[model samples]
Target: MNGTLIFDGGCGFCTRSRNLLTRLDRHGRVGTVPFQEDGVEERTGLRPDQLAASVWWLDADGGRCGGAEAVNSALSAALGTRLPLLVYRLPGMGRLQEAVYRWVAANRYRFPGVTPWCQQHPAGCRPA
Candidate 1:
């Protein structure tokens, strides 16, 4: 269940989403980081634009998935079930998930979001 969830630090919506994920992750099995942080690209091998486009999940074993798939992975780990992943794999469900995720991502700013966590707690944002 251990993994890293990379997200957009500048986007309030993304930050809030990460916070929600943290709450659901009672076990703290998933670690989250903002892609804007220094060396994130080097550590994840993901470009800035790619990270900006969608959330990413990097499993402990080095496996990676982005967009809706990433969400599925994070949720599965947090909830301790593969239901999300299973549903996502169902026929036509993947496309539906992708479309919905893209829509939300595109209109994320419209939804209410808290201030970026890093801006509020700079010292705690970066990994030591």
Candidate 2:
């Protein structure tokens, strides 16, 4: 489970985010798993809706970080630097980031190219 990111496989946005992370993870520090895939729920204990609400990161130390915390960690790891990491650790920053994340999550269906099935049945939509 170390350094793994369990994401909503059904969401186009999540797929694109995963791809961007993969490209930035030159040291192979990050691995991605789609929540809709077989065995993912069993392994992560996260239901599909939970995963859709936010990104989740399992660190090498076995600690779990979610929402904006996960995003900050992933970005810092991908960049191989500590500045962005520091920003995330700053007081109030994490909370602010999480707030923005929630707003975006709530409106993801409005984004172009979001599948019609996802728009019609958000909870039921699985990765295509």
Per-candidate TM-scores read 0.91, 0.78
For residues 35-82, could you state the per-residue lDDT of candidate 2 as single tens digits?
A: 665666677777766766777887788688888778777777777776
lDDT score for candidate 2 against the true structure: 0.71
Would you list the C-alpha lDDT of every candidate in the order shown? 0.87, 0.71
Model 2 lDDT at residue 115: 40
Q: Which stretches of candidate 2 lie over 4 Å from their true place?
A: 113-128
Q: Count the backbone clashes (under 3 Å) in each candidate.
A: 0, 0
lDDT of 1: 0.87
- RMSD of each candidate? 2.8, 4.7
Candidate 2 residue-wise lDDT at 57:
83
